[model samples]
Target: MVREVITYPNPILRKKSKDVEVFDQKLHTLLDDMNDTMKQHGGVGLAAIQIGIDLNVLIINIPLDKEGSEDDGKQLDENLIEAINPVITHKDGELVFTEGCLSIPGFHAEVTRAENIIVEYFDRQGQKQTMEANDFLAIAWQHEMEHLSGHVFIENLSFLKRKKFEKEWKRYLKENSKK
Candidate 1:
């Protein structure tokens, strides 16, 4: 099932997600739904909170072609990463990447994140997994993990940039309301 993604200004997006203590059928279903939703929205990654669920879960599946690979631009299910209760165990260096969120549609901003990271998380089956990711993958982890902590990438912007974004966002909301 492709769940509706909760947008910005929704209180649920600000609510800190609770850790998944029970690895059961419900968790599995949520993960499945998230994958469907992410693909439907054409997002490289998604957090559980993005779908109005307050569980510490997120998935990342960058298209093979996006990494300059020879394969066609398709996101493979086998490459989908389900991170439950993820924690950034290590971070090194820094890089800036343009990021867009499903919640904040039509807005892309350059956000500085760790260039490399070691994340410790649990897979869909409750098995503990550790991933060492760099470049775009590392940025994805930092972005989605922030959602689990009730933070948004816009918060990382400079004061001036954030204020500008706020003005533009308010205008966008007004236009959207008319629709």
Candidate 2:
């Protein structure tokens, strides 16, 4: 089931998620729903918090093809990653990437994150797993992990950019509400 993604300014997005202690059927169902929700939203990644569930769970699927490339629409279910109680064991270097969120649509900002990372997490079956990710994958991990900690990408923006986003977002919300 594709769940409704809770949007920005919703207090749930600000609440830190709790660690998942049980790897049960319920957890598997949530992961499946998250995958559905992410695909439906055209998002490459999603956190349980994005769906108003305060759990340390997130899923990411790096698009198989680059944007604007000839084979742009290609994707594989095998690429889907489900991380439960993820912890970044190591991080190295820095890279800045424009980040967006399903919970904060119509907005993006360049945020600096580790260019490479080693994450320790549990798979859907509760087995421990380790992943070494770089570039876009690393960025996605950092971004979604922050959501689990009650932080948003915009919070990483500079003061001027954040202020501008606030003003513009208010206007955008007003315009949309009038429609």
lDDT of each: 0.92, 0.92
Q: Give the TM-score of candidate 1.
A: 0.95
**Over the stretch 101-130, how does candidate 1's per-residue lDDT look in tens digits?**
999998999999999999999998899999
For model 2, residues 1-179, the per-residue Cα lDDT tens digits are: 99999988889999999999999999999999999999999999999999999999999988775442324645568778899999999999999998889988899889999999999999999899999999999999999999999998999988999999999889988888899
Model 2 regions lying over 4 Å from their true place: 65-73
**Which pairs of residues collide in model 1?**
none
lDDT of 2: 0.92
Whole-model lDDT for model 1 versus the true structure? 0.92
Q: Candidate 1, which segments miss by more than 4 Å at Cα?
A: 65-73
Clashes of 2: 0
TM-score on alpha carbons, each prediction: 0.95, 0.95
